[model samples]
Target: MRTYWDLCVGFARTGVTGYGGGPSTIPLIEYEAVKKYKWMTEEEFGESLALANTLPGPIATKMAAYVGYKIKGPLGAFVAIMAHIVPSLIGMLGLLGVLYTFKSSAVVKGMINGVAPVVGVMLAVMAYQFFQKGRQGLGSKWMIGMSLFSLCVIEFLNLHPGFVIILFLTSAFVWSTYKESGKTLFTRKQVMRSREEEL
Candidate 1:
């Protein structure tokens, strides 16, 4: 149970050093959430990361808000959001004053080029971890099938992804509820097997 001030301080550090925008900043958020603060486990971070990507808006800010609300309340959310933006706001102001002075520097260009691969690797690692988390959940076989189906729908069928997201979410909720209630729907084939042996 951290205070609003704690949330502000913690999120502020990430906001200040979070270079390369939303996708790249994710790994930094993961470090703060899972490593430094232990606010969430690695698996929880992976799942939350996936959820954040699904929603609209900036990924880093979304994650920050989620974390703040989880630990505190709406006031903490406000504080966290403010802290996350302040650094970028201040940085931009400072940079604007000296923009022309450093814009053409070769060293600055080199630093940007160098950070690209690191950010890519971090995103790759996060993706892999999330993949593993998804593969381990209930209806995982259907999950695998849907992954391919989603790609086909997007690439070949040209369906909007929001529709697919809604479809899968609804189905998963229904499936999970049925499974949890011990009520089988598509278990006609298994009805006979249960009398003789468990499947």
Candidate 2:
């Protein structure tokens, strides 16, 4: 119960201060979910992030659902998801009302302009964090290759990010299975060779 409340508060803070956009908020979310709370490990969070990015809907909400499910099953998921969404919903409604009222206000325009660069900086920081994490997880060769592949697909080929994610996941699953099977076969061959030597 207490854990659930902490998660709610953590997500609420994420919702409140994630000014730039949801993608920009990802580093902060990872920090809270993986580092601060210890709810999940870095690898687990990375896997969840990849899975979330592949699926539709908001990244933040997907995070809330994943974290919620981790902690308290279905009910925890509900609480975390609601906590994350309610603030944004209220803020959007309030902002819409203000925008209508102050449509002609130069001050509002200046304020938005002022925040735009800050948002860009926030997004850059998040990108850097993710890059650092990827480097750590994937090591040098594969990291560079994967990053280059991603750049080519997204920039040159204009492939969807979701498609890329699916490819990555499928490749990882197949490689893991292959490696495991290879190890088992090698072990069996070694045993058979020892028996032949004995004969």
Candidate 3:
């Protein structure tokens, strides 16, 4: 009911307002999911975004479907996908002729150029937020090290982004497990020392 409507409206806004494509729409989607409806926290959205990037196909569509499904299940997913793409589909159909007619017009070119910086700023802001969150959780040193390593691997070595994500995700999982085990062992040792003292 209300959940479904929210899904439709949120995704619709993203689909219609996003000018540049999948990447550009991410900030809009993040706002809707994190700030507007509170479907997920910023950290959850960041993780989901990373997971979505590792998959094939359109990122916005995938995000829309996932959020919808998370909120209201399969039916919500269908509604969300339709809501996200149908407006863009209709707009493209309606504007195809106009775009073709003004294909060489300077105004159209300028409009596109102007939008590029806005989209870039949106991406940069989201990235900075994610970096700040990471620093808080992992500390600045570990966060900086991982960021530099990832940048070098992807930019200099030309490694695939999906592989890098998988690598880091695995490392994080292993690190967490190791930390948990260490805590458990430390607790057990303390318990044993207490019993020995009592004896």
- Give the count of colliding residue pairs in each prediction: 0, 0, 0
Most TM-score-accurate candidate: 3
User: What TM-score fits each model?
Assistant: 0.74, 0.85, 0.88
lDDT per residue (tens digit) for residues 1-199 in model 3: 9888898899999999988889889999999999999999988898888889878899999999888888888999999999999999999999999999998999999998998999999999988998998899889999999999999999999999888988987888999999999999999999999999999
Estimate, for each residue in 10-76, the C-alpha lDDT of model 2 and write its tens digit: 8887887777677867776877898889899877887788779988998988998989899899998
State candidate 2's TM-score: 0.85
lDDT of each: 0.80, 0.85, 0.92
**Which candidate tops lDDT?**
3
Question: What is candidate 2's local distance difference test score?
Answer: 0.85
Candidate 1: tens digits of C-alpha lDDT, residues 89-127? 998998886776887899878988998888789989977
Error of 1 at 177 (Å): 5.3
Which one wins by TM-score: 1 or 3?
3
lDDT of 3 at 65: 86
